[model samples]
Target: MTEPVPPRLLLVECPGLEAPDEDDGGLHLRRFGRVVEALSSVCPWVDAVRPGVCTLPIKGPTRYFGTEEAVLVRVAEAVGEALGPFREGGRDGEGDVGSGDFRLGVAEGVFAAVLAARAGAVVPAGETARFLAPWPVAVLSDPELVEVLVRLGLSTLGGFAQVPAADVLARFGTRGIRAHRLARGLDGELSGYRVSGMGARLVAALGHALALQDLQPGFWGGTSAADERAGEVLTALQRRLGTEAVTVPVLEGGRGPADRCRLVTWSPVVARSSPASSPGSSSAPGRERKGSRRKASQAPLEPPWPGRLPPPAPARVTVGERPVEVLDRSGVPVGVTARGLLTAEPERLSVDGGLWVPVVAWSAPWPVEERWWSTARRRAARLQVLTADGVARLLVTERRRWRVEATYD
Candidate 1:
């Protein structure tokens, strides 16, 4: 368990605001709301783990902003600005609100990630156990267990981690086992740290209508408490997990399913705003993006990865890596030409070195290509084939190698 590598995540902590009191008149919650809103601009999946702590998957931002260190800089700046608005009123109520009010860190798991944020340090990859070893057992957040462990000379997580897993389970039961996992960096989060339904509570604390409140579920052509609640739950889960952990399919213009379909973070606001652009046969398993027609006389002869495939959509889209062999009646291999035409008719096919099956019918190969002069240009083709066994399958070829692209039931 010492090497139980943690997930890469980014955490934001607001120390002064974690324990908001009645005397603060709900200002802390409102300010925290602004923090979440600002962070949403940086990442749609900002999880409000609790009142003053939150986390987001660090991978996307790291790749986008260049590095984990860069992500922390960017997040700290955004959170600072969010808390900036309340700064002028610092003397009135908000206490010294400034960029220093927030801290950001990057780590692999939620528990380690949270401590990293509080300390404003990045827990280097594979170093979570090292980073946590010296911390007191109290950070585990089990006060009663903390006392017992401390009394037993397990004052620090490192010592506590030395306790064998079996002993922890046999002596201290489930709670001790949980704490031991945290010590050894085997668990990223515990049960009680994240508040249930935090999204709903945040909305209630804001005490104001949301930007898209009236049309929250309008994209589905109707609205209901059920839908709104569901959206809230999704938002909560996003806060608990990272945004990349949740996604929704979006249809866009392309010749094939892989190019036309994408997975995006599910947001009711986005759902309501985006249009239903793709049109496909009722039989297709998924919604597809439709390519627009050219108005000018001299556009490229072939449409740019545009247009729907003729009629009855595929019942299934494939992972598309399954290799295949296609041959003509003469047993010569078939191929697509520089002119985008087949060199020979496909008379039979075999999948993954299995027995050959005669091809009873196949549509004309549809050419796929890049611009004529691009150095790294791509050239491929897709064809529909009906085999002797009566299975309707879609096949594609590039550079003479063939593979399954989809299947029709």
Candidate 2:
């Protein structure tokens, strides 16, 4: 482990899990979440860089673990443990599953760290430039620039880095300037690689439903006009701490909870709208109205949300994925079949390796097969089950694994 540059970053990348449009219906995202959680034990500041990828500053972990090599090994072990059960003969019957093969590497910043992860090599301290030299321009991910560089006889990062900064900028504009910095190991992150609010979206995909804050009347004064004050305060906070400082959860029309809700930055406009406002209400502010109201023939009909859970919806949606082992009377794991029917009656329920409780009653599975023709196609099912303790829960399963999705009071 060579000395680190200004700030050393350790990157963990799991091949085959980077595609956002994979057809696993978010199983990959949830597994990545688990990997992130596991890495948190090593360092609290672990960052989920993107799907199938995460990074953490190596300073703290190295100090605690004694060496950068040790930290890398520890991180690898943590990810492996988190994704254990799904490694072999998994959902696809191929020896491939979520984070099945994780690669780890350390470098001064994110751009180099990612390359190091792919090559499974740690960039020596202050030697990032030399380490990145041999890689072809294709790794830059800019096809046009790669074409230009090849024609110009500068086909490698080292060659590109040798170009005078002024010349690169004048020829390629700001984009080329940034790429040159990356090639020179002067920049850490690239724009457009990170998906905004991806962590929140991942959590929301698992059934977390957050409510937007509602304005309340002032205590001392009679109907204190706090709406305006609230907006001012939120605006100030955003300006100080950045726009992502304040966010409000909004539920929209979709087939499932994940599709229906997301966190959007809070703004005065968002605060002014009524949460109870239903369809036909003046459209919500901020968001563009693409298909607001159809012409005379195409009225804006209320979204059916077909197959959505009936009223008495779960009181709380779990924030994280809770792995549960549903067992039948024979003590074998219960599974769902192709027809969306259970292989055996569920006789007991256990939440996150908890004590098993007797299952009393259950509802018919609500099978869902959405977007069947697209790469984003998903197939899963949900069922409501009651335990002998009189508690009810919503359980969802994809690829024959059961998890607690939500709980009812």
Candidate 3:
């Protein structure tokens, strides 16, 4: 047997990309190019094949940069610097970029490399088989040829490689033959990233608490070891940004304390709940309830985008053009409460006074009347009002009284 040619692959995964928001696709690719440019600085010979994707001929970098491990460390650092601003708000308290959910995979070949990236497997050379054998055939669904192999029961890459190439083509056609060749490490093919980086990008920061911790099967707390790792990453990000006031903007529409803020022109808004109605069980009980409430809001409504329209809760952080301090010696917000954004009047409320201020805002009667027959809770009215501070949500109680629940600051 003769020696097989060496294969070196690098796979990068960038998460948090939303589907395109417009037609041009140029802006998307441009942003991706920026990231590629940053990566190019560390490894100059890298090929910027697409906006979000790039590859370095690993042999050159490994040789020039001293070692494969050293090259990867440089790549990781450069990527974090370039992409860190994007993941500004993370659930884990660590504020590192590419630290949120992005991953990288290094392997001996392109197929194995991409699989490793998806699986979060960073395989060293001479170990592709250990990494590739366990992955199911589903990942090969792309390239059309792999799907044929899967349908023929050659589900694993290892399995595909073992089959005779001539027999594979005879049974499954030309595509299968091509797939077998690639699977068996017989070919080297690279697809130019023609689409570019086409998507919307939002930066979010995982809270410091989230970064230093992992879920313990059924519990929530930071492991001491993980906490040290988080501290190192946080310190690195701080050193890069050159600021002690680095606070990530809270993501809007989050389930708790943070949400997006928009500068929409203020208007009196009407609120309505999706009338309780399940699909297909119609015309008798459920249909009657929905029909009864059509008169409440005349606007035609679509089914609730699952959980998108959950009752808005008052978010607790301060949001402004400048960063707000999040902690003090006691680990408490020295400046304000969670609701301070909704009530604190910078112009009127004196700093020396108590945190609470009396502001008149509308509150919807709690237990707003709903379909009486079904189990769904309904209310007669939903409160919509604005304050000098911002917007607020009030909940009516079972006793028919109202209290401020949440505010949009």
Candidate 4:
């Protein structure tokens, strides 16, 4: 059996930092997500560490595209298309936003890829050590370690790497050992374990034998060791506590507070790419066709609905079985009147078994009437209120009852 190929990694850096305001930060994060989604179209093994930095394992793509340079060119073009019209002043005359300078780097490992990105260089396979040799020890980002290296006259990465590995470990501990390994281009040695093809075959045979013996295999084909271990753990827990014991969060898109997200079974395959499928392949089930093209043509992921609540969205939203009470000055429960107006001004609000909180400020009520022509039709008006304790809440009134929809921290 042939040995597994060494990973070729690509690092992509976005142009800017997050803005100070919450809304601005959300916008930046959304834009960053778009970039990663776009890159996923080219290579599914993309990992976005933040809005500004992401890495992709490009070994498969480099082969599929014919050459490493070809893959790089394709990625650059894809990014440029996805981030349309980002000019110097942030927007063009037609109001199209443009992304600023983007840097791409390719190397044998993540650390090397990051350094290559900083210098806008691509280090070829088996040459990572040579490329990193002349770089300064300060690149490690540990000021204390750099000072020690400087005092020892080891200013370059090569000099630092030349120190005995055992001595480095003895002096600076694990962190220093890791830095020394990277400086010596031993990233793979430090981070990954190499299992021979014979060993993998033996493990697979053992799994099959266990399955035949009426025992669960707890392993799947073509998955990483980490994924197999997680599956085993989940299987053991479920066997002891039943299937419903384990669940994972799933983010759903919607306009309502309660409809936005939910929980489902923890399936490892949910995020894993299929080994038999290629990126942008139409043959893959449930895979989008022309997704990349559509993404390139559309505006960024800005808010789709107008007149919605602004950012710093609610941290907690509770839906109660019974309605809460809102009262006016005369101690009367405030209800919606005939003309869609409140029977009396809302001065204070209280939930069952909870203390009344005075309303400090409020905005005009916005009415929503859904499925008006059907038997399930419902009408409600939503009010945004700030309580005396400086908490922002969304309240909705249906029929004669008031309920708190969400609370913003």
Task: Assess each prediction's global lDDT (C-alpha) against the native.
Answer: 0.73, 0.73, 0.45, 0.63
Model 3 stretches astray by more than 4 angstroms: 1-6, 17-27, 90-101, 142-151, 189-409
C-alpha lDDT of residue 175 in model 3: 63
| C-alpha TM-scores of all predictions | 0.49, 0.49, 0.41, 0.43
Worst 10 residues of 4 by lDDT: 208-217
Model 3 collision count:
34
Minimal lDDT window, size 10, model 3: 265-274
lDDT of 2 by residue, 322-347 (tens): 98888999999888776556788999
Model 4 reaches what TM-score against the true structure?
A: 0.43
Judge candidate 2 at residue 146 and give its lDDT.
92
Candidate 4: tens digits of C-alpha lDDT, residues 233-282: 77667677887778765545433465455556655574353333321232
Q: Which ten residues in a row have the lowest lDDT in candidate 1?
A: 289-298
lDDT tens readout by residue for model 1, 243-273: 6667777777556656567778878886556
CA lDDT, candidate 4, residue 319: 58
What count of clashes does model 2 give?
0
Clashes of 1: 2
After superposition on all C-alphas, the RMSD of every candidate to the true structure, in Å, is 23.6, 24.3, 23.3, 19.6
